[model samples]
Target chain A: MVRPGGRSARVQASVHAAVRELEAEVGREALTVPLVATRAGVTPSTIYRRWGDLQELLSDVAVERLRPETAPEDKGSLRSDLEAWAEQFLEEMSAPTGRAYIRDALLGGPDGTNAGQCSAYAAEQIDVILDRAADREENAPDVETVLDRVVAPMMYRILFRPEGLDTAYARQLAVGLVGSNDR
Target chain B: MVRPGGRSARVQASVHAAVRELEAEVGREALTVPLVATRAGVTPSTIYRRWGDLQELLSDVAVERLRPETAPEDKGSLRSDLEAWAEQFLEEMSAPTGRAYIRDALLGGPDGTNAGQCSAYAAEQIDVILDRAADREENAPDVETVLDRVVAPMMYRILFRPEGLDTAYARQLAVGLVGSNDR
Candidate 1:
């Protein structure tokens, strides 16, 4: 539901808190509109009016939780920074909790807004790395290219065939992109 | 439901027909077990017993539809063959219906069986191309590498950011895999 300005942060905060508590107590699958409303001491219509549905609310909450906690670690060279970031991304995104968040982010929206937001987060980090290389007069591909070559494959592996993934694989993707044998 | 041998092909055929018709008539979002059961002339319990839920049943139908209709076209060289196959794969998978099928195959179950089956179809085609290169005694990477470098990224792009994907992008992925530079 689109408000004239935006949703009230106060309501959002309490609802989100209720969702987290209910998710912990009863898990994600069992969450319902009435359950969340009762926990938050609001009517079910409040949730429906604000979020449209449970999946939408869940996606909103997941997107909030998935916001990057810190900037990508600086590891000197472009390749090293990308490799380190890629490794960390794979590690976190392949964990059970990370996997669930990814699913929640994607499966909640048919419009692709949440999924696109997640991708944008990765792109912002990639751009920071690219900007660093530019500052250092080092050659680095654009953010989209890195996303296509390095991050995309890793995400596919994470979401599907995760058996062959490792930090070495992450480093290999960075090397393929940079094309230097100095690793 | 796990039968002594397997589910009856007749029941499956009728149920699939009902689902397809209902999907066309009411669309996927409006589908329900009762609606499908009434259409198929079967009890709702039968559907639950057989497929566990509407999503699982939808996934099963999608998997059947997603099976490759023909082998990867033979283009006289491994590079050409792979390029041709990758272009076709990307084209089909990025289309609206293809995207729906991929989503159906994935979003149904946490068990990953349906998604794994779809990946297997792609892997089987990749192996056929690999076998041809091996028969010609040319240098070639393994199926896993092709999957990692080529298909995985393409899938990620299809599922997320599909703006930059095209036949040229598909060919470039093929070139990256088989780098003779004679294309």
Candidate 2:
């Protein structure tokens, strides 16, 4: 997507791309402002002046990259809709890049930087599903409830445990949250 | 708890204490093996040989510190028992030191060093509660189920959000997991 802007927008885009590429190659731990500056064809001073620190740059990158590229299509039922959304989410988050993005977003800080934006994006997806369900006379759980019951647990295990998330796990969570086995 | 051992065990204990103190003082991000070695009155070479890296040393300290000092006492029923356990667990984890321990434990690695041990310890707590409920002819959800439905969500928010955990949250989780409000 090309942004209709001048030199400032071009530099911002370049920096964002550099951060993502560097993060993927060396992992989040190894990424540095100097390295990003080199990769983005900008000076270290520019990066420092624009973002203040690596954490803030990471927060910006995470906020941009972690948001769903497109909204999930509304499936017929709450169960199917939730499962589909979760499956897509899990798939995205299972990749090394996605995982790194989420880790930065989540473990960043209490400051309303990346984590808050990322969470709000996630909550919007849940709201889309719940709103669709309400239209079908289905009593869907609230966004926080669904997040607590399904999304948080899946992400918890994925981040902390060796076990990977799968479709079956997503289905089970959907059933658990919705209190129904109907597919 | 004193472990009856020679020079190696004593060194390990001192190093662990130093790690905890340093973590509490400077937070985990600023902690280093050299600092810990200096504080513990050991050579940096010793730390390098035993723990391999700062992350590994952190994993060890976190595994040791994050485990419950004593198993939670079983209340009469599953609901009360779960609520009691969760409240205590949340209280411990809400502290800065405890939160640091948990962050180290959870975000430590995919290496299965600290995360595996920490998860096992948590599973054991769940087992104790379930076993007690079984003795009273009451049904209890499996460890994974309870973790998915209750503990994971709590931990996720604790780590990611600024919101602190409380008894009300614990009670709601207990009720949600057990599928009943009956005590």
Candidate 3:
């Protein structure tokens, strides 16, 4: 059911909206192909044609929804750039959707299942931050280390523990991860 | 049914064997109070006497079967301590059973059903490493920082990623986290 030319603006909007609604209601699991098609009032074929498969569709939606907000505007120093990155990371985690995403990543599942998706997504995000840090000659460690030490713990505390994610904790992690990179 | 005092050593051994067999076959999901009692050749009441509920019995079995091995002799440095921890963490993630346990934690289902059980179990494991690190004044960073950076990341990586735990990546994290505290 491909539109004669390409997916119409309305069809794309409807598909995106369907994904958002499902994700909000029940995390990532509930967004099955049929469910999204039904919600979008489009044929399943339409979704398949546009997004290829469930994972691709979900990944696309996840990327759009979970994209880190505005990149840091050229902070003069590595420390300041990292501080900006940490603040942004904390802001993302504080949101309801961000918390849900973190829980899914942490407790997600085993290898070859959907469990790896969140961590992979997170690693990509860290790469972006690391690239920014690298531009300033900072000794930002590899993406995996950044994720394991800095991002995962914050998400874990927020999702599983009663202890809340606060500015103070975020700042501490910032100092430990970024400032300590060279020291 | 209360074992009329206490079960004979043979009876206790039989019960433990049954638990091990059931866990090995169908996993924790397939385990049931009645099935365990039947396999053990004991009355349900007898099983209840020893363990108050199915989950308790399962938890006991889990603790016995999946207990962490003793840490390696410390090399009097944070780097060695972290590497020892990383090796153990990788070993834990290598098992199908361990992966399933983590998957269950994430999808512990609605209503906050298994949340407390999962949280308490994870906290106990974390406490062991945290306490051990705390004893090493020369090598370990402050307790809170170690927990945040080193411990949390290891757990998160094991439970989430499909790839072999990145030992070099973890080594770098340990150095960065502990080295920063020295300054």
lDDT of 1 by residue, A38-157 (tens): 998889999999889998899888877877889888778888888888888888888887878787787666777887788888898898888988987887788878987888988887
Best-to-worst ranking by DockQ: 1, 2, 3
DockQ of every predicted complex: 0.65, 0.53, 0.36
i-RMS for every candidate (Å) is 1.2, 2.4, 3.1
TM-score of chain B of each: 0.91, 0.84, 0.61
Chain B alone, candidate 3, TM-score of: 0.61
Candidate 1, residues B76-100: lDDT per residue as tens digits? 7889988999999999998888988
Clashes of 3: 0
| lDDT tens readout by residue for model 2, A1-183 | 346697889999999999889877998789999999999999999988887888778878887988887777877888888888887777777677677777667555546456667767888989988888888889877898888877888777767664756878877887777857344
Q: Where is model 1 more than 4 Å wrong at Cα?
A: A1-7, A179-183, B1-7, B179-183
Better structure of 2 and 3 per DockQ: 2
lDDT of each: 0.85, 0.79, 0.63
User: Which regions of candidate 3 fall more than 4 Å away from where they truly are?
Assistant: A1-16, A22-37, A42-64, A69-73, A104-117, A130-142, A159-162, A180-183, B1-23, B26-82, B109-139, B159-161, B164-183
Best by DockQ: 1
- lDDT score for residue A179 of model 3: 79
- Summarize candidate 2's per-residue lDDT along B38-102 as a digit string, tens digits: 99999999999987888778877878978788877866888888888888777777777767777
What are the per-residue Cα lDDT tens digits for candidate 3 across B1-183? Answer: 335345566666787789889878887668888998899999999878866777566554554444445644555555565656655655564467765554444444332334334444445554555456567654454545555665567666665564666566666666666655433
Best-performing candidate as measured by lDDT: 1
Model 3 per-residue lDDT at A156: 55
Instruction: Provide backbone clash counts, one per model.
Output: 1, 0, 0
